[model samples]
Structure formats: C-alpha cells, structure tokens
Target: MPKSVVSLWLLVSACTTSPSHSQSWDFELRVVARGLQVPWSVLWGPDGWLWCTERPGRISRIHPETGEKRILLSAIEGVYARGEAGLLGMALHPRFTDSPFVAVAYTVYSGFVELRIVRYRYDASRDTLLDPQILLANIRVGNIHAGCRFLNLPDGTLLLSVGEGGIPALAQDLSSLSGKVLRIHWDGKVPADNPIPGSFVWAWGLRNSQGLALGRGGLIYGSEHGATTDDEINLLQPGRNYGWPSVEGYCDTPPEEQFCRDSNVVEPLYAWTPTVAPCGLAYYDSALTHLPQFRHSLLLATLKGSTLYQLRLSQDGGRIEEVNAYPLGLGRLRDVLVTPDGRVFVSTSNRDGRGAPQPDDDKIVELVPKNQGIEDTEERSLLRLWCQERQLWVEARAPVTVRVITVCGHVLVEWRGLPQQRWSLQSLAAGWYGVIAWDGVRREFSPIVVP
Candidate 1:
C-alpha cells in the first residue's frame, strides 16, 4: 500500500478488569520502502535518511520522503543468518558530524554460532560505511532466541541486549554474556562506572530481549520474549536480575517467588500471556498535535500479535497508567521508530520464515497523521532541534523564531531570525520544556526533557 490513509482507534485498557476506552487516531500507514529480506532494524539517521538492516547481511539507506533505497553495504562477512539469527540492530553516533560512526549487532558463525557488535565508520564523502571494528564478539548464540538490540547513552556509552540463545541456564549465569544487557564504552572497553567492575553486564536474566529504548531521565526500557507465556516490557536497572528460567514474569508461583526473593529479581513493568513477541520498543513523549495520546508512552511492536502496544507512563515516568493497542494490517512488525517531530515508522517481518507475505513481502511503513503537513514546509525540512551539554540547540534553513517555553507557558529562551543558535539551560531546573519554532504563519512543537 502506498500513501494509504486509514482512520483507526486506539484500544485503551487500564487492566484486565477495567472497561476498554477508545481514542480515535487519524493515522495513515503507508509503505516507506519494500521488498527486503527481513528488515530487522529501522533507524532514523542524522543525515536525514532511514537506515535499515536486512537480516541477510545488508544495510540500506532509504530516502524518507521518496521511498528510494541505496545499499550502503552488502553480504557482510561471516554472517550466519538462519532461524531468528541475523544482522539485527543498528545505531548511529550521537555526534555524527564530528565523530562519524555506525554500530551494528549480528550473528556470526565461527565454528559455533555467536553474536557480535561491530562499529563501522561512516564515510560521508563516499556515502558509505567502512572500516569494520569489532567491538564485542564470540558471545554464545543459537539459531533461535539470539537477542540483539542497541541503545546509546548520552555519556557516550552503548547498551546491548543479548538473548539466552535457547539456553535457559545461561540467563542465571553472571559470568556468561548471554541473557544480559551489557554497557560498554565506545572503544570496546567496559565503562569505569559500570555496575560490575571489568564486566559489561549491566543487567541479567533475560530470555530474548529484542527491544531497547530510553525514556525520561535516561531510564532504560526493554521488551523480551517469554517461552510460552509472559512476554514482558521491563524497566532495566543496573545489576538488577529478571528471573527467566525460574520465573517467567511476576513472582506469581511459589518457586518463582522464592527465586525472586533470593535473586534480587526485578519484576517486569507489564507482562502479557499467550506471548505477543514484542520486538521493538520506542519511547514517545513528543507534544506533536496529531499523536497527543502517545505522549509519555512506550510504543512496542509485536511479531506474533501484529500490534502496536502503547504503555502510557505516569507523570513521574515510573508507572504504567494505561495500556493501548493499535492493530496495523502489516503482519509481524519487527521494529518501530519515532522521529524527532512526530512521525512513527515500523518495519514488517512477514518474510522472516513466518506469517503470510503480501506482494511487498517485507516493508517499512510510515504512520502519517491525517492533519500532518500543516506546518511550514521549510521548518519541517530544515529545523533541527536537540539537547546536548546542558544546552538547547536549534538550526534552521530559513529565518525562524525559536522559543524554549516551560510547561506552564512561560517563555524562557527566545531567539528571533537566526539560522543557528544554542542556549545554555544550566541555570534552569531539570524538567520537561517545550521547544517551539515558527516562521510567521506555521509553527512546530517538540517536547524535550532537560536532564
């Protein structure tokens, strides 16, 4: 489907006992790009392109507006892709202009199957990624349940989630790299401040975590697949344990309750029975007009259920206040991406040895709100706003007025008719602020948390 606009309602439920509520969202899910061998990861690149990783060892850059794709690299050396194993996660450097680097995680076969994290240099002059630097390698992996997802911290550290590789016992082994979330420095060394000295394991006891995202205050969130039941979305903490083999989700069973008390186990924020196979997780708190219902929520994409699960967070970003489900016709959603503005995108995994594939078997679909395109075209295309170094930065192609307004409608920082600007918020208190940029007639809004 190309440029398909469909009206849909989000199914909201507080709990199993609570009655359901419906919120209408005028979202138009359309094909961004198509025909890929299991597009595992779809990341929005700093260079204004959609970067995608195909399971069969290929990375392509897709034009977001035109849906045109160009292969950056292909037939990655030593990739052993099979059932549930392949090139999976991709992440770009936070400072892409200064330090151009791209990181990827994939399964490789060296005698035995193993998972690996490699960093590639983005050569912008040639528009290609080169110079493969293997950061971490030789982690145990199997044909199935080989988890791989990446999240980059503001402090220049990287977090990766590893599956147990169908070996349930490995989840409890702290010495083993399998079934753990590892935090490592950019140069492949363990961070000095990591929970465990000389160890990259930040958290442990996961069956197959495929989704990783960052929420407010740098809180880490992950989604994992359970064996038969209890697919979970957990708030990951340093050195915390999530009972996998002994306990599926919460400590509902006697044995699991005992294991939890002894093992420092942290229960999942939310768990689902009949396993939805949640693959990709994204944190959304943008104040975009179209998707107001998704603010302060975690967007989860599932494989088996083919649904987008939105878990709304509380005011303090601690609890899940509500759970909402939106069904997209695309089968087996592998990954989801939320842009800085307000766009949401998901990659289809129908061709991944399961589900019924459509004419465009595997595709990256974009969710465009019905009332989109009302903003200034130039502001939408050229404005780049972000937070770094306790400062708010804004760049625009044309002259525009930028304002840093508090949640209570107080304008703190204002810049008029500047192509580029940066304002220090060091004196301001830590909380959420609205960044607004406008050119005379049309305005844009981006909600950001000042940490």
Candidate 2:
C-alpha cells in the first residue's frame, strides 16, 4: 500500500475552509467510551441515547452525560465472526419512537455463511431487545469483502450497501446480491417501484462499499474501497452502474471508457490514487452544528488512512466545493455520527487485527467546536443544562432569555431570568427539546432529552 497525501482548501471561504479559518470553534477531542472489540456502526438514538454496534456481535448503549457503558445485547448468536465478517451494521426504524425497531446486519451460518438483516423490538423500559425477526437473508458474504451499512430514507425505505465479497465478477452479476446496493421496504419487502422488477437492487457494480450517506436535495453519496488505488467517493444514482472490475475510479483508460459507455456506468465524484479505505459517511445539515461551513459538508471516516475528511458540497449538493482532511492521530476510524447538539463522535477500529491498538484498544471520541462560557463542566457554580433533569440551572453571569424549542422547530417556552435561576421544563412534553440562550447578541444552544 502506498502512502496517501494530505489535502485541504486553505483559500476557500470561511464556511468551507478547515478549522484553521474558524476561531469560533473551540476544537476538543476526548474519549467517551473505550475497550471495544471492533465497533462498527454508531448513531444517536431517537431518545438522545448513544448506541453502537460491535463487530464482535453485540450492541452497547452509552450514557451521553457520564459516558457510562451498558451492554444492550451481550452477543448475537449465529453471528459468524471471521476476517472482516461479523455483526457489522445497525440502524433504527425511521419512526423509532413509535416503531421501536432496531435492525442489525450480521454474517449468519447454518449450512453456509450468509449475510442477513435482522430486526428486533427495543423495549426501552426493560432496556432489552425483543422479538428478533430476519427481514432480509441469504445474501452471499465473504471474509474480506462484506460491505454492510444501511440508511433509512425519509419515506421508510431502507438503502443497504452490499459488498462484492471479494469476487470481482459478482459486482456485475446482478443475479447475485454481492457488490450492489439494495433498496427495500421497512418490512423487508421490495419496493413496488423497484428499479428492477421483483429485485431489491437499486444499483449494481459496486466494489466493497464501506460508507453510505444521504445528502441534501435527494443526493446520495457512497465511499467505495477500490481494488488498490481507486478508492472512490461516488454520487449514487438510481439504477446506475458503478464500473468496478471494468473501471476502477474514472474512465481514464480506453477499455474503461468502453465499459462505461457499454454499461452506462457512472463515474465517481472524487477518488483517491492511493486507497484511503474510506469507511463511514455523514452529512452535516443542522444549525446545531454551530459551524456554518460544515453545515453542508460530508464527514467521512477512513481506516487505512486514519483521517476524517470533510467534503464541502455545493448549496444544491450537486457539486463538491472543497476537500479538507483531519488527521485523527489515533487509529483507524470505523464510524462517525453527529449529535443534535453539533458534537461529532467517531469510533476507532484499531483492535480489528489491522492497526496497533492503544491502551484501551478502541474508543468513541467527540469532536467539538470552540465553545464559550461554562468552562468547567464538572463545576456547578456556573450553569448547566441537564437533559435528563429537564432543567437549566444558572449561576448569574448575565441576564439571558432561555428558549426551549422542539426538534420540530416549535418554541415551547421562553423565560427571561437572571444567571442564578432555574428554568423548569414542566410545560414542555416528554421528548428531546433544543434549548437556546440569548444574552443580547450572543446565543448558545443545548440539547435536552426529557424522560
């Protein structure tokens, strides 16, 4: 493997430039959770709880406040764990508050090793998963090439990325589920308007696609692991083919051009000459992020390169404005997710038999912006917003108005109080609410999850 070079747009406008351009961001990196056997997928749950899937076949729930870890599922039996094969991806039902369904992708074996997507009912009261049901099954899986990450669309449709499973020919062979992206209903049924009749394949010819993300304006992006030097960031078009064995990155060669023309293959938006092994893709489209420049960018995690790349997209999300890479200095990063509070978290993959693990091996890290006020989080002398308590206790710094807003953008309460006062959230319903404070001109927002 060749070494990859670092690149960033230093001349771009402040919104899209690297952290060096922003003094508003008080960048902070800290471990939230540690000691994991290859954590693969992570996401902030609907209840504002942090959840993670371990590749060794278990799910963990971490306390957002204290970083206390709890094992939701000790082990998913029948999960065939091997080289690059194990319990991999996880996603929550689109309406998780009502549906309460948790889905996971794992390699299962009876007579043969098969990739399966299973759903379970999460019992919040009991803190356990129940009623395991296999939604989709029998997709061929291999040790090395098992791309399995899923993202739920707005309308409850699930988009799943399937790896070529180390077989170059399987990518082009639509008859097999390997090396393709699949789309299906939440109930594991093929959509009535599937690109191919009776098949869940939305697009074919993908090499092991490790990262899948949806962007603004219906734009979908995927990070693909190339054969050697053609790791790609692709614009996933419906029913379009991404030339894999035939064409690596772009149609730079004559044969690749012929293949592109013959198969109607779509070229990647951007690609790396030396494979960076991009694994996770996240789109920042929230005002809570605080950083305006990262609002429309794609945050990607890499394994071999061990970098976090932010690809700033155009307003319409059709074109790329610039690329900025941040070195983790830690080990390989497997997955990344941004919370409703604008704090970004990444899971390390150092213990996956590839990179050298640190003392604790793997961890969940938080990336934050330059913050103001309340310097010491542990000290109660200043102010604090306890999500679980649904109270903002202040220590009288300045006269500020506290506004409690819902996730749906509705203001529930607005109370003007002194710094050393308490604002009770008794008026707001039980749910996660966004609370913002404004002192004349300066504004700060925090997240609160009501029990």
Query: lDDT winner among the candidates?
Result: 1
Could you tell me how far off, in angstroms, the CA of residue 36 lies in candidate 2 after the best superposition?
1.5
Residues 371-421 of candidate 2: C-alpha lDDT, one tens digit per residue: 332233333222354323434333334587776665433567777888667
Q: Candidate 1 residues 1-451, lDDT tens each?
A: 2343322322222211212522354565656786787999999988788999999999999988778898899779889899999999988888889889899999988887899999999887787889999999999989998989999998989899999999999998989999999999778999998888999999999999999999988888999999889999999999999998899989998999999999999999989987788999998875655467788889999986457888999877778889976656456899999888767889989888877665656888787765565322332443565455536555665678776766444568887766665445456576645555667633445445455
TM-score for each predicted model, relative to the true structure: 0.79, 0.77
Prediction 2 global C-alpha lDDT: 0.76
**C-alpha lDDT score of every prediction, in listed order:** 0.80, 0.76
Candidate 2 shows a clash count of 7
Per-residue error for 390 in candidate 1, Å, reads 59
Clashing pairs for model 2 are: 15-293, 25-370, 26-369, 26-370, 163-179, 396-419, 396-420
| Candidate 2 stretches greater than 4 Å from native | 1-26, 286-288, 371-451
Kindly provide the TM-score of model 2 when superposed on the true structure, using C-alpha atoms. 0.77
